[model samples]
Target: MSNQATPWSSAMPEAQFQLMHDILAAPSPIGLEAAMTEGVLRPHFERIAPDGWGVKTFKGHAGIVLDTHPGRDDLFTVMVIGHADKIRMQVRSIGSDGKVWINSDSFLPTTLLGHEVSIFSEAPEAPGEYRRLDGGTVEALGAIHFADPKLRAGEKGVRKEQLYVELQIHGSDKKKQVEALGIRPGDSIIMNRPIRHGFSPDTFYGAYLDNGLGCFVAAEAARLVAEAEGARNIRMLFAAATYEEIGRFGSRVLVGEMRPDAIIGVDVNHDYVAAPGIGEKRMAPVEMGKGFTMSVGAIVSEQLNRRIETVAKDKGIPMQRDVVGADTGTDGMAGVLGNVDCAATSVGMPIRNMHTISESGCTRDVLACTHAVAETLLAMDAEESQTGALHEAFCSQHPRLDQARPMGHQGLPESD
Candidate 1:
């Protein structure tokens, strides 16, 4: 057990809440996460890991490695991962009506209609501009005309298509003027909404809540561990990875580089909720405000999961168990599959309306997850972490990992 109080067990609730608000205020839509990463996450990380820890950024994927060993060349490392990127759409073109074209791998065109959006440009300096776009009714196209009314065409639900956005301005000349302001094709677009508060003292709502909440929890956990003194033998890594909504692109790069003894991918998990057509697909037995979740999936290491559960129970932190069949659809699977030796599992904050702008969760659950993670990391021993019995068991279940590609062969660029 760790001598240090589970850092963030007390004052961290408000801190995590504020951090979540700040992260949500910034517009971080998918590939355009440079602002969230370089602008927001970097400064916050520097503040938390100011001493000997080496902070590095790779293509907007930022990480801080805490070297408890200091000058020692060899040290055991455990990584906590969270994606900095959120799902968003890209600008396809500028319509003649001074409107913008929209396309996304994740949202239906109808769902975006009438919703406010923030357009992100390459502006590494000032963030993007916000505008409201009308999602015209099914009977008629709104301010921006769609080539096909089919944009809203599903009898049962909204049909997804390439959509369009209209600014308050109009005409081709006005469109050119708007483009001149640095808004151009290929920029990213995301739903815009102010943070909603007081659904109850414990709950709140906002956009990008899916994984941003995870990042906030991880940051709080890191703050506690960095400030503690007794953690001298086990090195810890805090990875704010990007581009997880589309795929595990950022995490694959990070896990290959860090190659930690164990990795915990922090992300949002869904609980019981009803959706059209899909019915209760969004429902889980877990509840927000109740606690964090330990996901069971193909990539989750049973031993690592048991360790986390033990920590949570011993510390009296509330927690729940969830199961996802083949893939958990989070970075935990990516890290585990890519680095066979590293033990991997996922810790989730129960969230509602995942992937939509108005995602919501309980602040109490966020703090609980932070406390659980901090306690788990603090309790880990270097010698015990390096053992790969779980990895051996996983390999036995899937023989092709050895035949198709051997372990310890994949290499990543050296960390800066």
Candidate 2:
């Protein structure tokens, strides 16, 4: 019911759409994010980034940062991170019947049932080399006829411990047969779904859209900043980070090493307006195809948020405010977790069915976020040109509560 035109109908370039598709299609599940960070994101940055831009890699993880104006002490440094990791299941144990038991970390058991998946096993002989096995479907208590009365009546909930992958192995020594194929404990498993346009205009749905959309936006925004005219007074670091699903460990490492003056964690937020059974949850009414989301609470920097809001207003970009309570729930918390002194905030596109095979998002919101981030960087660059101390200026701009004047109301008297 949105008025926005679909990407097919709009002016979105073919190459951009293709890049988005490729990023989402790349399997970079949690601990195995090198597939995306190295294969997909690094290539895209190398191709489009300007001559002065250089890519930096972490020793501890697969996280990569594209840096513009590196090692400039005079300039403010801002890191815009989009996690390249997706939640995944890990091979826990294999049974003699050829059933692959998986630890469904971060995924509800109900969501995994009946969904096709691909398990990636690192060849023990080759160390880092991975072998992917397809044609497996997640299953639990296979048939309704075999289900107990409580399960049939939905009185019992499915638990992750009971789930196993149906690989349909035939013949004796099934466990050895699986092992011969390079499958083992601690291998990664992910949904075998590809990103596709949705029935609605400007919408996309697929597995791993949770954070792929984030990386895509960060890449696009970096491209925009690189192409823009003017001498940048601030160094922009666009990072495709890894291990966000596990505990944001990769981003924490990146921030601790880079030590940027500001950080913007670009990730996905739930489209609470369209969420089922979300009554009285007090969640923001963020919806797909509306605009990008800006985090307001938690460890978010008010001055940085205000700057982004000003930039969005000036550029005519649409955005929604998201209230994140204890944490932003994205890489936005990376700086805080690492005890780094930096201004941090989160920006995201509203998504539906996060952590599921069919996560949904709006292309329009993605594009809007890209523009908003790009413009905010440009705006800060412009500010630095005039102020000559962008970081110090931002630090000094925090709102002073004592300076705020009290307003009179019908029931309350005005302050003197």
Candidate 3:
């Protein structure tokens, strides 16, 4: 039965969530280009860019749906730059006193496997003193924790607990230094913490779940929709984009080209840290183990929001709402101005000590967003007319959310 008809019988289900979790558990964030191409995404993703320099593209079966203009084409393509590559670990616990810890409670977010982790030298001169270890504790989706204390004199403030790991690098003998023959750029840093699950039901603690969790939701939903074949008119495009933190450029290109009727960009939303004045209402309120969060404000479109809300209400999809004053800091910007009828929202995970090293989130929350997105895909029109909504939302949020700074173009050629 269709999700609408039976309500309880949508293609995306609880079991699917578990399956998705395992897939996300795979090491290395995105499917390798060679594999994704020679293996799976080949049929759908069209490689439009020149190869080499870690760049690849894929042109797919479906295109983006343009924003309401009544007269648009079916070119709505949702480009997703996910974390299938790169690992930013926070294993080394640095005390507020600015002391370093290689073994203590410090932790870095890392992928699982015999994957190599990077650590610098204990160069006596700087960073207090810390170096890499041959082997240490880096559990899947986890890292070590340390005790926070003043390592020496004149150190006041401190971050309580921290963990760290060592990373060895191989460089040219001619170019090697003490810290050299160590870690280098583009090294795949794995976490020292192992992922653990409590006896508790449906709970998990792991690393890389930050975006991996998000990817799980998106991929599985696509799998389910394909199986059910509920609606033929709806064409689902699952884009595994890369280089988001690098500059959010991958999706930028997709939005420009795809031009979907409307887009629901699935991404991780920052959790609310109990700051002095920031109440739950003001900042996003995505508590772990809850459902997903919906973004509001400039980046997210009004009409797009309405559509998502409509779907949620129609189905039993659980969601929370967040209001963004200036920029949602999401892929929302691309959807709006990139020439598409788009509703930008997020399925967020409540991450703790984000960007430091090892990030945290609830597995349940991840699953919910995935399911919600899948339902959205099936429900989205293979070809929906962009009813000028993109332009309208742009006008409203443009002045306020000056998110994307203009990339000054090469001016007209000088006169002869």
Please say which candidate is ahead in lDDT: 1 or 3: 1
Tens-place lDDT per residue, model 3, 175-194, is 33323334332223344343
Give the lDDT of residue 239 in candidate 2: 95
Summarize candidate 1's per-residue lDDT along 336-365 as a digit string, tens digits: 657646778899888777776677877767
The TM-score of predicted model 3 comes to 0.58
Candidate number with greatest lDDT: 2
Residue-level lDDT for 336 in candidate 1 = 60
In model 3, where do residues sit more than 4 Å from their true spots?
1-188, 192-194, 273-284, 336-343, 356-358, 382-416
**Considering TM-score, which of the candidate structures 2 and 3 is the better prediction for this target?**
2
RMSD of each: 10.3, 3.7, 14.3
lDDT for every model?
Answer: 0.68, 0.87, 0.45
lDDT by residue for model 2 (1-416), tens: 23446331254576787899999999888877887889999998998787888999877788999999767755688999999988889999999888999999999998899999999988999997888889999998889998899989999988889899999998999899888888888999999999887888667798998898899988988888878953367888999888888789889999998998899999999888888987358788888877889999999999999999998877668889998899999999998998999999999999899989989888888888888998899999898888798767776888899999998765866679
Off by over 4 Å in 2: 1-11, 409-416
